[model samples]
Target: MSYQHYRLEELARLVQGELVGQADLCLQGLASLELAEPQHIAFVNADKYVEQAKVSKAGALIVTPELQQQLDTHQNFIVVANPYLAFAILTHVFERKHTQTGIESTAQIHPSAIISESAYIGHYVVVGENCVVGDKTIIQSHSKIDDFVEIGKECFIDSHVTITGEAKIADRVRIHANTVIGSEGFGFAPYQGKWHRIAQLGSVQIGNDVRIGSNCSIDRGALDDTILEHGVIIDNLVQIAHNVKVGANTAIAAKCGIAGSTIIGKNCILAGACGVSGHLSIADNVTLTGMSMVTKSISEPGTYSSGTGALPNAQWKRAVIRFRQLADVPLTQLQKRLDHMQTQIESLESTLKLRK
Candidate 1:
């Protein structure tokens, strides 16, 4: 009951929508059409949900002009171009404001580090020497910022997150809990029958408006920087190996792993559990379906799916048996059979032409 309240007209103005019906009606929060109460606002995206929106017991509804003409009911409405987008805009209006308590007593910030007065350092957060924390940035409890790191303004560093070994995070970035930035990548040299450790000398450069989810590991480069460009959204449990460069506005789903030195272009979509091998370059506007494995470089932009789709157990068994049998055939014999078939097909085509 203590949440924010807005008039029907005010909510409409926020989303640049046209207001219809009662302007004085107070909307408390947003909800789905089926779950909306009298004080809540609901949104109907498509025409299919127009009936549900009409019957919803909500204070108001956010809808398109096309859907607005269909409703003859007395329910108040806020008409927008995109009802879903309007709902997204209004969510920030009802977001609860958390009070900043300044720097907590247990936070260990170095004297040489430039901590902004507007920033909030939570309990037991460790900030190393020569670090620069910009204004309004919140380093939550149990987080660690290593030496020479720079975090820009209005960034959110969640609890148990580690920004270490030359991490440079830009403005409005959100790194969720337990995520590690600038960790040493998997690089070694085999010398004299032993593996020699190769130091990761480079940093992680994350651009503005990047949102990294929980438990993700972004490894530092062996020489050059590992870059995540602006507006990149990374899901949880993702592993990005050394020197990998991900372009702007790319969305990588959960559990995807990209090996060393790969360059993924802008506006690409990598579905869940997709694995890309080392040193490959993926073109822009490409989409990889779930469980796709890429071993070579992709030069063209298109949706690519690799491996086999799920099938019935009996069908899958038969497919596996056929695949194994094909593997057992000698390469020279297979080529000879293919050549003979091609010659016979050509002869048949010639005979058909003569008869015509």
Candidate 2:
């Protein structure tokens, strides 16, 4: 791996962290606490990992103030308010120094395409008719940008990405490899006992600083654009359907499926494996826990969860049986039992009052 050395003091100053270690110690790269080399920097983000940090052979460590105080070893360390955030900053610094730039000679650009001089088009990349690629944007090898697509400045389109016609991607967007944007949405009408396909005539509009992960399929709308607002982050294997509006800064994790015409509010977090049904509106700041199934609108902002926690096989089977039985019980019978209990309580209260 290509490596660059930075002094412990310099690294700490870059992240505005307090340094407690030897200033002159050079760090080559980042590594996990368990596997850190003598030239590498490691981080302890939580208390659980502090033991690992103590045993690590890293040249320097980045740790939260709390963690640093609790660590048993007197070691070279940078004390940051948030170790995870510091690590993230360092990662960006590392990535920028290593990332490739500049256009390749073998890229196929249409005569009508408007590509900025500063944009990088990789080998075997195809830029279609009337497409506009903004300054400093990088379209990686084997990726296809269809006609009339407008990609803004500083965007990174990874290899094998397919951005279909008329899609608008805003500045600083990062789409990972194998992602398919502006694909036809799932729309069909039943007629004469047969399913007739409906044309997806709209496009996709992705806002600034959005990061979409690998292998994601974001479908175009039927008549309006499927929108992802600024700072939205979508994880791998996500399926965002037609006309869906994912509000600003919302984060949807891996394997999440959001159905057509659903409006997910700002700063919402849909955890991994979550599924939202069609036409639902999830309010701002809502958090759906992992594997939760949302079937209707979420009108309030709060953490939501579904499905039982892991259980032993025999216990799980019994729980499943009881769960099915609960659904089978009549609502009328339940209400009658509740009424009887209320009546008994009232009778007891009356007798107590008489005795008093």
Candidate 3:
């Protein structure tokens, strides 16, 4: 939790914030309002957290202009247009800098693999033949890079990660531990009462500035490469099936599943635990709320949600029972009754016209 100290004035200037106290106040690290110490800085973004900020022990606070107005005029704080954004910037400054460089002796490198001198290859890492690991990249312990894979500069591949099937990764990508890239997708053909597996011959292409969280699986394509556009961020435990194309700057939350060949447009957000059916096309800037299920293609860009929110167990059981009985309802008889009523209405109208 150690941090390099910075002056209050300098910190405010770095985040484009307005200072309200002594410029020389020494700040060491960032913390939540409840956990902040005398030398730490905290933030209060919304009115709900104002009470907590007022009693916090932090030497300095970062707050929005509206929130600052409610605080004491003499309080030591920094006013920013977006307090959360300012706090995010400070997190980078507080993170510990990595100093390890050079390949570990225990790492296995193939004869045809190209390793950069500045790259850090941790113990037990295997670089396959014809693979290119770019400058300053870090491949942590127990990770395997298969043949012909290309990883760009400044990428971080965490421990126990597997990259195979000629996967191509661009610069500044961060793949967390236990993630499997270019794995075979679920593709089977039914023939003569038996199931046959299809040979997956495609690879995966990841664009720059993408961060994939731990325990996620991104499968390779059946023929073409599965593509992830630049600036994509995927949360933990997500499943991306074969030949799926995720557009630029899309953020997918944890536990989401995208079926094979689905094309998700740019800037879309799929919330946690959502599922998209196979081969569906999702428009750009679409937002699917948590636990949504998409069985059809979305052509318009807007927020979408599905599934009933939380309900009591008793009510949910009754609803499920009602839904199950819908198939038994006699729709043909209902239509016949409606047709008879329409005939009677036409007869009465004719009689009224004759009397007039």
Candidate 4:
């Protein structure tokens, strides 16, 4: 994607940074230090990468004032308090160029559906009966909004996403491609010798500013709503089971599986590949490290981790043997202590009888 050039002074104003470069110099987009061209801008956050910044071919460099002396030339320095944050700001501006601004005529809208005129529906998209798509929302191609679904304003639903009927999605939400929302939960009962599937009658309620990555599966509740509160960011390939409640601003990384009826608290971070068991309550501000297994409820707000790192085969074998011996060691020590105490007690009793 191509972007129009923004002047150094304008960029500084936009990102709330201090200008140290020639204000008239234009920057089209952001680039890494090694790949930057004369039309691009780059940022250096640490002194360790200052050498790369000096050799970069960027027209402008966003850096801290302390690091400005390391630059090859003073002509392209855009000094800031935080160079990383400045880079994020510039990248966001550059990315906005690729966003769809208006609706396309090729979109398929059901006669019973209501889509705001301000919404942008991309090519070959389908909006089912009685569906309500709000203002400034963008539904990309090959995406399906199933019957009676309500999507709020400024939502971005990427291509090939499937949102089942009766699902409620709020404003500023972003859903990536091929994700299945509001699917039936896994619920079955054993009747005699056969399994009887339970009917899932509940829907999913996704709140504002939520971001769901590609290929994630969020199952609908069995009898109540499966809720994802505002600002929840879920990564790709994650599985969120039925009746799960993920609190506001909680971020769950890729490949995490949350079982049914789990309540994950606000501002929590569940790292990649972590598995959380069902019917548990995890408190706010908790951080579960990568590949950690959560089998119990956590009421405290802190970082909890499990699982061991890789080790050499010989050392690992020794560690496992020692672990097995741990149970025997305590029992042997207790027995020896008990025997010594009994001997001392018998001697005292004999001395007392002789004295009497």
**Backbone clash count, each prediction separately:** 0, 0, 0, 0
Candidate 3 per-residue lDDT, tens place, 1-356, comes to 45599998988999999999889999999999999988998988899998888888999999988898887833788899999999999998877866688989999999999999989999999999999999999999999999999999999999999999899999999999999999998899999999999999999999999999999999999999999999999999999999999999999999999999999999999999999999999999999999999999999999999999888999999988887786666889768988999999999999999999
Query: Which is better, 1 or 3, measured by TM-score?
Result: 1
Question: Any idea how many clashes model 1 has?
Answer: 0
TM-score for each of the candidates: 0.95, 0.92, 0.91, 0.87
Q: Pick the winner on TM-score between candidates 3 and 4.
A: 3
Least well predicted 10-residue stretch by lDDT in candidate 2: 94-103
Clashing pairs in 2: none
| Model 4 lDDT at residue 289 | 96
lDDT assessment of candidate 4: 0.91
TM-score of 1: 0.95
Candidate 1 Cα deviation (angstroms), residue 51: 3.4
Candidate 4 error regions (>4 Å): 69-72, 96-106, 317-356
Candidates 1 and 4, the one with greater TM-score: 1
Clashing pairs for model 1 are none
Per-residue lDDT value at 199 in model 1: 95
What would the per-residue lDDT of candidate 2 be over residues 123-184, giving only the tens digit for each residue? Answer: 99999999999998989899999999999999999999999949999999999999999999
In model 4, residue pairs whose N, Cα or C atoms come closer than 3 Å (at least 3 residues apart or on different chains), thus clashing, are none
For each candidate, C-alpha RMSD in Å? 1.8, 2.2, 3.1, 5.2
